[model samples]
Target: MYQAKIMALLFVAGDQGIKEKDLADLLEIDRAALRQNVEQLKIKLINDEESGIMLSQYNSTYKLITKSEYSELLTKYFKTGLGTKLSQAALEVLSIVAYRQPITRIEVDEIRGVQSSGSINTLLARKLIKENGKKDVIGHPNLYVVTDEFFDYFGIKNIEELPKIEKFEDYKEE
Candidate 1:
């Protein structure tokens, strides 16, 4: 059952990816049954939601990963203090991209109310922002998505895990 499969998954994971044939042979089950079991395990992991584990398939190889959502737990966190190394303009551009991604340089300029070519270029070169491909409508300006490295550098796993920033209203009220 699921319990047996789960145990097998954990044991087999140490070798990197578990081949379906290997699991079937070890468990004395047919490929179809093994497939069903693995699918069921994937569903179980995903549905648990609370657990930070994920069943990711690298091409055809399968393994249980840390979801990459709790990356901060596995790596160093980003610092926002002095001597930390991000330039003011870099921070500004990063902010824009992080908050307004799938957005282009034109839109970013509009929001920041200034030119941002240099800053955007720097971000791209640094791999903080990436080319997420063309927009759907009109000119199809390229979109951008933050990278896993970004999470690694910032010590945050997922975007939602970013530290809650004070609202503009809160700052205005102060």
Candidate 2:
């Protein structure tokens, strides 16, 4: 009962996603009840082999997103031109997120010495990066981190597998 309603609300909420609090309020249920329903829904979706969509939780927000297995088909159907390759700026942002995970957008911008919102959005659309949590600060900005897709894309088992970064002085013209 609640599961179906929650799914409908998530579908309608779309990419913006809905916070657990909001879902609870809308469903007129307590947090415990909502959690139980959400958990059951997650299990059902995961076990449903025919289901292309799954429940994705990011920073307390829940969203209905297509499973990674359908990425190729979705890319072809949407023809978004994302299949070619990532742009240079996007790659840079990805690298920054990969190395400094749980970093905020403002921090990334400061490191890059420019605004990185666009690049961050591109990486997010590609599912290579995702919002991990809110930074403990004034504005509570979202912290970014590389997703599992990132690991698979790079063909590495873990972040430790990435090559070590050498100091700039190592390659200085002498």
Best by TM-score: 2
lDDT per residue (tens digit) for residues 60-121 in model 1? 55667766767875555443334247767778878777866778888888888967766777
How accurate locally, in lDDT, is each candidate?
0.71, 0.88
Report model 1's TM-score to 2 decimal places: 0.47
RMSD of each: 17.2, 12.7
Index of the highest-lDDT prediction: 2
- The regions of model 1 sitting more than 4 angstroms off are 1-84
What digit string (tens of lDDT, one per residue) describes model 2 on residues 1-174? Answer: 999999999997766678899999999999889989999999899889999999988988899989899998997976966664887777888898998888999999998996788688878887999999999999999999999999998999899998676644377675
Q: Which ten residues in a row have the lowest lDDT in candidate 1?
A: 75-84
